[model samples]
Target: QRQAMANNSRPTPTMAPNNSLRWERCSMDIDHLSLHCRQHSHTVLTEATPVPQWIDDRVSLTQVLEAMQASPMHVLDTEFERVRTFWPKLALVQVALPARNVLIDPLAFADLGDLGRVLGNGRPWLMHSASEDLVALKPLTEHAPTALFDTQIAAALLGLGSSLAYQKLVQSELGVSLAKSETRSDWLQRPLSAEQIDYAADDVIHLQALCDRLGDRLDRLGRMDWLWQDGQRQIAAGYELLPSANPHHEFRAAYKLPLAAQVRLVAVLEWRERTARSTDRPRSWVLDNATAIDIAQNPPRSGPELLGKLANCRAFPRRQVGEVIDLLASAEAGAPFQPAPAPLDRETENALRQAREQIDALAAALALESSTLCSRRLLEARARLGTWPPDCTRWRQQLLEPLVQATLGASSPTQNP
Candidate 1:
């Protein structure tokens, strides 16, 4: 029949949509699997001899520009350390074009101006789990990726595993599992070992292919808007070493303190930041939370008495003794207060609880952790500002705001209403 002829004539490609071969799941042989992948794949990692690090360093930057110009879309990844703070310091940067992969050493040559422009050029940049990468690079570059795509966003919409690992995504789409040996490579070192180099290269090289496959599926599923909104939220959140953040208002009743009490907390917070930066120690070490609370509760004036009160605190280094004493004096004099964590009433709570429910529902529908998508602080901001989460300003507003409205609309029937 005509239908039979039409079905038969729809030609299957020599390989897959990603140009990687579909290995017949039979005898389990890693060698056969690698062979199957390379023969039919256009992926960067499919190269028999992986170009781990950039060779011929003199013209490498120029070559990267050229390689990137031809291929407008590249994948980027980074490694860094930030166990102590909210932001990670970008230690290494990896860029993968469709045809090449190279890892940049941030420590060796800190100047990445050209590279930053290239990344920020409004060309689409793909990353998996992009939040950490965005935070790490904020200090180093003026512009983040202007056009960003998160493959994890796409995978979630496709009904794939909600928490897809990087390696699994590559394997699921590209049919290759990268070497696990270099999972902990210290990327900041120069003259990277062969294993480390290969691992780093593999980290980025497969991203484009994964993005392509996932992006196509996203388009087909009509979920591209979701991914776009998700990326925008992260892009707006930014990465900066803020001098001070108020933890006092973080508590419920404490937020209702008199203006002077609030001012005291802020002054103490500013002092803590200054001390931490000057000493290059952790913020908590500079002044423990309990100590800050105590200082704010009872404004300690100057001299031997104040010093003796804090004598039990061994963390107060000799270098900071004078500074700490001065900060106490400053707080005691006069401190500027910031008002409003949230209005203290049932109405505000209703609005906030509503925002939280919407966020929770949307997170479930999209298969991401709610906390990961939007924090409680952002939820409070939304309630106080009478707006949805910032990312909801875009395409997601229609989809997500309704749930927020439902939250704000009616109290529990169990209430006196």
Candidate 2:
């Protein structure tokens, strides 16, 4: 224990650890978690190094910063509520060092720039299913971590399931089963119960251990670079606040539509996206995708017909009807119609299946998942065009290029259906 500092109304500054990095978990008074929990004031006294250190004020936050400065790498996780807002409400931020775990209450403390700096400092962060957490990181620290070691992605690349739960990953890798009782609790509420705190702490508490195990497996398999590249891709995706193109353009229905209908769907979907952000509501509340499809396909010219179709959708506000009707009426007039190619015939299906079989055989030879080798969607598209493998990462292309060329080169007329 070292450093004498102010013992303000909130919990006093945790005893800053020496360079040895001996972090400890300590109890804090719950009544002082700011004015948000002023109504539910209570005194809590405990002595357990395993319990997370509750940080809700400036002094405690400063101490955490000091600890992070000593240790470049840390485990991180967040509890956020996204049901009611366009951006997630960052409720609690859990950060873990080898010897200590601390929960930072964003609602209580205002300045987290220090914590944000540590996150963005280009050090490796241990995380699980980090896409959503990266989004949640911004409002708290103002920046997402630069480097990541995502356990979920690493597990998938190493032949574990593509999408694995945090608890299951921990259990499989470390043989520890975590409790899920607080799975649906309102994280924004205060003061959080002891059980809630324990559960939140557990999310990050075991993550570092899993990262170590997964990293070892990937190292032995010599896919560490692959994991790093994939993690970077995941981080880049998290940075995209909106769709890369008109959101409707990604839908299967949009592709099946005539070019002019596709154009109209694009316009309405963009409108819905903008309205959803402005109103801070779900996309469905602004306009459902099914309704957008109907509007594009039918191209209702009259206001009565438009109203009749959308009449059942109460959330389709009447105030916006005039603009929507006018837009729908004129949607096809200027746009040129380009017909989509016919659906794949039985012969094309057979070709695609053969191409897929070749890829699967290659993937098995390399001891990798077929999906990991290349997505089925890309394979199917490329088979139609006689391009075996679609564009991919340089490392991935290097692995699949020879096999893909051989597969396409070997398909003779005799193999045709």
- Candidate 1, residue 154: Cα displacement in angstroms equals 3.4
- Which residue pairs show collisions in model 1? none
TM-scores of all candidate predictions against the true structure? 0.68, 0.76
Across residues 1-417, which tens digit of lDDT does each residue of candidate 2 receive? 001111111221221223122212122222211100011122222223355778887988888878877775667889999876666778989988646788888888666777888777655667889888888887545555555678888888888877788888877765666779998899999878766776787788666555555666676677766776666666666765645354553575466787778778867877777777777666776677788889988877776777787744555666787788777666653334343345678876766677678778977876778898778766554555554322344456555555555444432111100
Instruction: Please give the distance, in angstroms, between residue 51's alpha carbon in candidate 2 and its true position after superposition.
Output: 0.7
Off by over 4 Å in 1: 1-49, 83-89, 156-164, 171-185, 239-247, 251-260, 274-282, 303-385, 389-393, 406-417
Best candidate (score: lDDT) = 2
Candidate 2 lowest-lDDT run of ten: 31-40
Candidate 2 positional error at 224, Å = 0.2
